[model samples]
Target: MAWKVELTETARKQLTRLDKTQAQRITKYLRRVMMLEDPRDAGKALTGNLRTYWRYRVGDYRVICEIRDAELVIVAVEIGHRSEVYG
Candidate 1:
């Protein structure tokens, strides 16, 4: 089944800080890759305290998401550069 993806308010704000091209790239990745039968196939599971979230790499940026399997939803919690995203 195809999973649904939703961006949190914070994620949307973070995305707006990026350039138009980068923003489009992240959104495209979400629609094309994250909306598949299994979003996990497209992203790696975060380690440590973030183990509950999944991380998708898009160039220098990282999209952190929470996968709710029961609801078939992927909630985009945070979006930022890789270096600072995990902090």
Candidate 2:
């Protein structure tokens, strides 16, 4: 029962803006997310819309990701900075 995490295109571009250390940090966070049995267990909040956000803190940066059910799987829609995430 492992959670599946998928990165959106925007998130992929955002990675280029991060420093080497931060990039590695994001990779580590992905590993943790992969180990999750339930995506919601690691989810911090849900606005009751079509979105749920799972947060992972890496130093000063926050990795904000979205989860949605795809058949029997949970899909990670996007990942980005906290500053521009909620807005």
Candidate 3:
């Protein structure tokens, strides 16, 4: 089943800091990939303290999210470049 996607307030701020094209690309990836498929197939599960979250790659950017299976929802927690996203 398709999942519902929501961007957290911090994630929204991060997206706004990206260039227009980059931001659009991330949004497209979220809608077309994350929302349409099982989130587990779209991104890898993060480890460490972030083990509950997943990371989706788009070019140089990464979209960090948490999947709630019971709700069929994908909540995007952050969006940023590869170098900065993990930190």
Candidate 4:
């Protein structure tokens, strides 16, 4: 099965603020997620929230998103440095 990826406004803003390395990291992580890797196999989210789940070590950044629509899509709401990813 295949799914569609959507970038939220927060994520779009975060992308512009990242350095080259950070951007690359985010891209790589997004690819893995696009391919639909099992969440359990992924690393910790650093800070676990009610609506957001984290997929850590997305290259060098953290991917903070929510699983919705029966897990057929991802709302990549935020991407940022590990320290800034949560909270």
What is candidate 1's local distance difference test score? 0.92
Segments in model 1 whose C-alpha atoms lie over 4 Å from true places:
none
Cα lDDT tens digits, model 1, 1-87, are: 777889999999999999999999999999986558888999999889999999999999999999999999999999999998888
Residue-level lDDT of model 4, residues 5-87, one tens digit each, is: 67799898888788987787777766676676554355454342443464546655776766664867766777887777666
Q: What are the models' TM-scores?
A: 0.94, 0.68, 0.93, 0.72
Write out the backbone clash pairs for model 1. Answer: none
Name the top lDDT candidate. 1
Query: Tens digits of per-residue lDDT for model 3 on 1-87?
Result: 778899999999999999999999999988886556577887899999999999999999999999999999899999999999898
lDDT of each prediction vs. the true structure? 0.92, 0.63, 0.90, 0.67
How high a TM-score does candidate 4 get? 0.72
Q: What local lDDT does model 1 show for residue 2?
A: 78
Residue 66 error for model 1, in Å? 0.3
The number of the candidate with the highest TM-score is 1
Q: Residue-pair clashes per candidate, as listed?
A: 0, 0, 0, 0
Model 2 RMSD to the real structure? 2.8
Q: Quick one: ranking by TM-score, best first?
A: 1, 3, 4, 2
Whole-structure CA lDDT of model 3: 0.90
